[model samples]
Target: MIVLGVDPGSRVTGFGLVEKRGNRMACVHAGIIRPEKAACFQEKLHLLFRSLVAIIQEFQPSEMAIEDIFYAKNVKSALKLGHARGALLIAAAHCGVGIFEYTPLEIKKSVVGYGRGTKEQVQYMMKMILGIRGDLHLDATDALAAAVCHLNTASFRAAAHHAGGYAK
Candidate 1:
């Protein structure tokens, strides 16, 4: 199965596509979407939405995973993030891809073995786990980590179902 993970933001969004086969998982693509610097706020949102739609069309992932809304000290920052996330959700829904959300703590724990893992820890784990080569943006790596977490969760659920155990 292919999973698309996203780290949404108004100025810059990160995305990664991870494909799972048998016991192996690989990142097919990972990158950031940075709208032109001179663009207006609305244009940035539109760009994010349009870019993700193209990506979903290209990769055709079966599902998408993202970070859930977390408490923000700045209400304005939180609202902008919500808008960005809304664009991502709309993109996924438009493409008929299933969407799932994981809290930052859950994503960190799943990928770094610590609920409060630092961004560096997640970056390190993303490279080590996915065998990713070269450098990647912290945001991009975080996005890939989300995909890895989902793949792990899905595998566990499937195994439980196979053994007639609780899956959720």
Candidate 2:
């Protein structure tokens, strides 16, 4: 299964794609979608939407895993994130991709084996798991971690369903 994971931000959104075959996971691509500076809010949003739609088209992922909005002390930051997330969801929906939402805690635990793991810890585990070299800044790595989390969780759920048959 091909999974696209997104970490939404107004200034710079991070995305990563991974494919799972059998029990192995491999990275297809990972990068940040940065909006040009000095652009107005509306223009930046439009750029984000366009870039995300193009990414969906290019990757053609079967599923999209997005981080759920976490409460923030800064309301402005939270709202902007929500707007970016809305664009991401819309783009994925337009491509007929199923969307899966994972909380920050769930993502962290799946990636780092601890819910309160530090960013460095998560990044370390991401690199170790994917056998990636060099550095992946926190945002991008976090997005990758979200993808890994969803892949593991969704695979588990699928196996359980097959094992247990139908559950209402």
RMSD of 1: 0.9
Q: After superposition, how far is residue 71 of candidate 1 from its true place, in Å?
A: 0.8
lDDT of 1 by residue, 19-123 (tens): 999999999999999989899878888888899999999999999998888899999999999999998899899999999999989899999999999988999
Clashes of each: 0, 0
Model 2, 1-168: lDDT tens per residue?
889888888998888888888888878888898888899888888887888789889988899899999879999999989988998888889889899999889999999889989989988998888878888767778888888999898878888799996533
- In order of appearance, the predictions have TM-scores of 0.97, 0.94
Which residues of candidate 2, in runs, are more than 4 Å off?
165-168
Give residue 66's error in model 2 in angstroms.
0.5
Best by TM-score: 1
Q: Assess the local accuracy of residue 7 in candidate 1 as a C-alpha lDDT between 0 and 100.
A: 83
**166 Cα displacement, candidate 1 (Å):** 1.2
Model 1, residue 82: what's the lDDT?
97
